[model samples]
Target: MTTVSPLVAAFRQASYPVGGHGRKNIQVLKEALHEFDDKLESDIYGTGESIEGFQAEMAAYVGKEKAVFFPSGTMAQQIALRIWCDEKGKRKVAYHPLSHLEIHEEDGLKELHQIESLLLGERDRLIRLEEILALNDEIACLLIELPQREIGGVLPPYEELEAISAHCRANGIKLHLDGARLYEVLPYYQKSAAELCALFDSVYISFYKGIGGVAGAILAGDEGFTAKSKVWKRRHGGDLISLYPYYLSASYYFKQREPKMGQYYKEAVELASLYNSCEHVATLPLVPVTNMFHVHISVPKEKLEPILVALYAETGVGLIHYLRESSEGVCSFEVSIGDAFAQIPKELLKRTFERMANMLQ
Candidate 1:
């Protein structure tokens, strides 16, 4: 039922793909388990070393009173909103139009919990502070996705984030951060994880996203808030009998890649700059705020596909996996810098982009 575009098809065939830390193969999981003990006891019903210990570590990492691991961000985030709605005696929550809850989750929030969504701001832009200020809706929570993914991974100014957090607190609105790619933004903001988290009432971060782990997410908040989450976790069947693999990979990569975010950020700027210099090609934001940006090409998908295929074949540098049409004939695809970018040869990169420019012209 799933289809792969020619761009992705070619990118997959390229030997020098310029994205991701590495192949998401058995090797990735193998590296994470390299130091882990085989005789270690696995967690049961969310207890023991792998589960609870990692939860506590993450709680400290994000400067929260408590944290709980979940099988997916979807389950963790829905539970977060449900708890706030119950406490505030409201069933409606607010977030950007492109929020994962609104666009991706297929109405799980509405169907499962009877919670309604009050969408804020337009789809093509980040939610402005003024939009939150004008909100007269009696919503229980306001979710802000840092570096909103759907819109080229753009972030609001840090001052705006502070103001939004203050406004939410003053008005009794629980501000939730959909920080799926939280660590990726820290370098741009020049702030610590705890400092950024202090502004929000609840935070949900993913391990498989920018961290490049197998798969898992953690929801962090005050002890009281987290206690309520555990109850909902059981109700949602989020607790597997054992999830040591996800935990191990998450912990290993979190330690391995957390310090490299600054380097990735710099590489993203460099990559975006090269992308913008190509004829008929540009990047959203004109530069990157984090390790990701959208490469927009002023060409239709049908015509662009062959160019990318040839580009990958000739240069062996697969820049992106797919294309998404914006309006008329313009199309785009996202690029997130990771360990692979640094491994690419500098001379090869120059010829790759230069050839890409010449080809597009």
Candidate 2:
């Protein structure tokens, strides 16, 4: 391991105390609470409060007839898949090999639902429409991530997305979107969340991604689908007696921060373009289509961690993350831009990277 630099050490110690992960909006939250307490005090935990109001708002936002909130995306998605499998009488779901379904969710699809995943798509690219069309008969539903995350937020083209969705519809295969960062992609795609979501039978969105909710996910679809999902939610142990805090946080963020997604997308492209100009920084897909991009640093293995620690310490700017090894000494990592990154001085980001690169050399 290489030694940590003093610059990196200083960066880590500087803390933006209020900001949490995923670009939180503290001001919006405060306002939401004041309103919640004033009009929603006794109805907290969804007892007498209008749960349907939130659901209806989410459904409208995503262009669906109904929406259901889950404590977590994991539960919401699993239940979505389970419902699809039951309805279609097929026990297979097709998704990218790197999708949250296969990578993040611990085989619960198999263990809990006994459904098999027909994984497609290469490690570094979008899953092709042909891939889904070929397996159209076997798959009960096709789960598509807008920008595939594991490979650094690569998105399929709109035409390709429409083609795949059409294939699924033509074959009677349900389409479910694993849109954890759906808000991030809308700005880049020049489409509204509802417009993008209209292609699928069910769409799931996270309140904590670009929208800045503390933690919660909404699964949107038709009224019938949501009604069925409630049953699945109960079966999977996701139903809560009260979801007030989650709703409070989710509604707070959704109303305040969701509109800023376009700004985040615009900033991400500029950020990626800046890094693309750097000599040592090579991007995964060459350009970011959403608010997330990964930078591959060609530095010695032993030097990587020290540089990361150093960078975090010096400028309090979180940069690229090396999740795993790449070919040669180069390590690839992601840069997920959010509200904090929005507030960060561009010169500071530039300086941090410049210093780190000099350290490596």
Candidate 3:
């Protein structure tokens, strides 16, 4: 028998609204698994109709000449950078300091590809046009993340992004988009997916993040670029024997949930507004530019976790399952609005935070 932590137990037993997807019940898991049953009659390998269908659909949707599926965004991004570096004969790539490549990849870019990351702009802010203008070093590519995830889903102004794109083009530097949450952020920009991808030489999108797939990523670019990426995907051992499950789930969710992102973004803004009204709890960025934002609480994690657990135990509302502590003793957690969030009433959400704030007092 395994022992469940008190916090985990609280989350498991709660009946009211909780964050993001609400712990995938057995029924939900079965439903997702059944998607594979339908796919079993189709091609099983990476070479067949199922994988090719997803790739073609994604390419057309992103306005790329081609799209290649990969097992993970980390592999896709690293390979994209490697391709650009090899083509440009320059090893440097520029992106924000908080980029997944810089912080999460554990220096794989430097160690594996000998790619030098030129950190651009200040942390917790959008990379500005002036930063691009100031870069004198010859670089392979400029990678930009829409709704920059690390900084509360912040995005640069549309004009600034266009200027940066133009600058990169004029300077003969390639541009790649780390659009893991691209679908979620599209409603705010009011631009079609293709319009946005048109500004970049390459774009990488995660099937799991916004699309709610089990796992996979798509790299979209020109046919030549995608062809090269396929070779690299094989080299990186990302070429799975069969990708039907990932493709089927990705394709299914892309159709079902992608259209609802605008509603999610609207709900996020409304929810954040409610948080701002409470004491000791605030939404980072004050306004959400996308469907995700961070909630910063004035309580330390050690103190806050118990409160969350207690609240859930008493009220059946699991407000937070976990909290990340900052150096200043404040605790923060990300709130990503999706289908689960739609079920939560705005008034109840407001009351929950109000209760949390009152408890702190």
Candidate 4:
């Protein structure tokens, strides 16, 4: 038996959306399970019809020669960088300072792969092409996270992104896209996944982030890259015996939600506009380019957390799960619009922000 914290319990039982789909209930689980009721099982080592079918579909979706599924994005991306480093005989890779590989993966690349990270650009801004050009060191790869997540989902201008990609190509550096939130930004990019992927040597996307899968990631690249990745995947213990459930959920949601991301992006813009209008709340980036953005509240976390919890209790609107306090004592939280947000009327969201403003004052 396991014990759950009171806040965790409240979030789980909350009737409203609490950030992303982290609080999926039993009914939702059963519905997703029903989707796989009619499907046959995949192979023990990821060779069966369902797994191969999803990988092929994703490869075609991203315009890659091949795609391999990994149990986690951490494994997929580290392996991708390792492969590029091994091929080029350079241990250095450049990326934004806030990149997941740098900030979130707990130095796995440094410890496991012996890869050194060259941090590029300032925090909370898109990496400029001049920043890459100024680097004098030899590097095997340049990892770019489209709509960089930690910086309120900001993206480099399309022209700048193209320039960077061109520079990487001219310098013989492999460009890999950490497109964990790729689907959410496609509408803003106004390009198909394939078109964006065409610029990179490899791309990594998460099944659970925007795709709403159980848990998995797809690393797509040329056939040789994917073949080598498969071996590394096994070496890294990501070769699960049965990954059919993740495959089925990813396939189902990719079809169901990928097509409607543009609508979600639009909704996010509308909601962000309303939030920005509030007196005490401000959205980072000032406007949203994708379906995700950061919300900063003037109130301290000590006060804002309870207000949010009470608001959910009284109005059945779970605006956020928790707040991350900044150095200045202001609290910031992320808003990721999805099916849950699509259900709420924009007027109601506006009112919610207004009410929050009143509470903070």
Model 1 RMSD vs true structure: 1.5
lDDT of 4 by residue, 1-361 (tens): 7986444455555666735654555554455668775656656786987788889999999999999988899999999999999999999999999999888889999999999999998886878788887654399999999888998998877878788788888888899999999999899989999998999999999988877777789999999999999999999998989877677777777888899889888878887887788777889778899989998878777777777776666666667666788657688888887777766665666667778777778
State the number of backbone clashes in model 4. Answer: 0
TM-score of each: 0.97, 0.88, 0.94, 0.93
- How big is the positional error of residue 208 in model 1, measured in Å on the Cα after superposition? 0.5
CA deviation > 4 Å runs, candidate 3: 1-4, 24-29, 33-45
Candidate 1 at residue 165, lDDT?
Answer: 89
Evaluated at residue 2, the lDDT of candidate 1 is 86
Give the Cα error of residue 258 in candidate 3, in Å: 0.3
Top-TM-score structure, candidate number? 1
Over the full model, what C-alpha lDDT does candidate 1 score relative to the true structure?
0.91
TM-score of decoy 2: 0.88
Candidate 3 TM-score to native: 0.94
Evaluated at residue 90, the lDDT of candidate 4 is 90
Order candidates by lDDT, high to low: 1, 3, 4, 2
